[model samples]
Target chain A: AQSVAQPEDQVNVAEGNPLTVKCTYSVSGNPYLFWYVQYPNRGLQFLLKYITGDNLVKGSYGFEAEFNKSQTSFHLKKPSALVSDSALYFCAVRDVRSGGYNKLIFGAGTRLAVHP
Target chain B: NAGVTQTPKFRILKIGQSMTLQCTQDMNHNYMYWYRQDPGMGLKLIYYSVGAGITDKGEVPNGYNVSRSTTEDFPLRLELAAPSQTSVYFCASSYPEGGVETQYFGPGTRLLVL
Candidate 1:
């Protein structure tokens, strides 16, 4: 039961606008989305993944994410927002049955307030 | 490439006193994980390993306990310490490219059970 659902605990953008952080996932087969970024004390920083092809996915500083295979979602984008790009935003889903050892199933974080 | 490294960054146990949270990874990464970040409950997977001696149990492994002979390192063992076992503790490492894998993380360790 791979799960991940960051409905939004906080997300208030301002600096240049355009920012979204909302993910949804529940795997069974074909689903490996991820996007992490934390700051306030450090740890977690890898902002892109959508294992497949062309569903938008482009990570790192500028950030990007799309992969919406009929609403199984994966959305973390940024058009301008700055203010150090806020922080705390995680959404992961990769249990692949757990035998592969790549276990990850998180998503209860989304505090990105980039107001400047 | 320190890639993953964790130690006592901060601690304050008491309840039943017991500790051992140290992780290391120079990148050889066959896999390695141990997570626990509670604020909004984002991360949770108390143990993992796919190399060295091999280990398992994740998704909040009861009070926690782990080990991996050496693929770098992987240690997490908290015998009793309660208070819900504080929070913030992460250590990650990855390998297995192509099939997709990108774990790499470790700048955390802030247990506080008192």
Candidate 2:
């Protein structure tokens, strides 16, 4: 079984500053990682994902995440924060290598507060 | 285009009441899923359907039932509503076959049971 952990419940950052939402995972083998953002009253929007190749993956709205195999972490990062980015972020993993299981397992989610 | 449509954006149900949450997707995706979002907890999959007339339980499917009568429609049913079931329900659809196509989500239906 695979699981994800978002260590931070909430992360506060001023606009124009860098921000990071921590995420770690435990899986039997190489895992597929994903990041999603959810605004108030809205469903989650896909941000980025790491399937194979490149350790650094970029996705919608100027967001990116780093996949560290040695550490089993996939941390979401943005160079410049915006108030619009103030929302709930989630980290998910799918271990396709786990004997034909392809379901996604998600973290508890990190609430981001980007202030102006 | 209506990517994913969920009926009754907000609903308040009394304890033990039964209701169904309707979901449809125009994308003709083969896979549909129902997930509930609670505060601090990410989305927990309640049920999923890959094709018509095929449904399966997810991470949390204790009091929920679902049916996929058609390719576009997947409805979630709550037989006995409880306060523990009060959460934001989201419907999502994605293409199947192992490739990593993104899952499109509906606006969400907020349900409160008291």
lDDT per residue as tens, model 2, A29-93: 77888898989888888898888898999989999999999999999999999999999999999
Q: What is candidate 2's CA lDDT for residue B53?
A: 91
- Cα error, residue A24 of model 2, in Å, equals 0.5
Q: Which ten residues in a row have the lowest lDDT in candidate 2 chain B?
A: B95-104
Question: Which pairs clash (backbone N, Cα, C closer than 3 Å) in model 2?
Answer: none
lDDT of 2 at A28: 82
For residues B5-79, could you state the per-residue lDDT of candidate 2 as single tens digits? 999999999999999999999999888889998877878888888789988888899999999989999999999
Q: Which stretches of candidate 1 lie over 4 Å from their true place?
A: A1-14, A17-29, A32-65, A68-75, A78-85, A99-115, B1-11, B14-16, B19-34, B37-44, B47-56, B59-77, B80-109, B112-114
- Residue A83, candidate 2: how far off, in angstroms? 1.3
Clashing residue pairs, backbone N/CA/C < 3 A, model 1: none
Candidate 1 lDDT over B1-114, as tens digits, reads 668889889999899999999989897988888899888888888888889998888867998889899899999999989999899999899987668778989999999998
lDDT of 1: 0.88
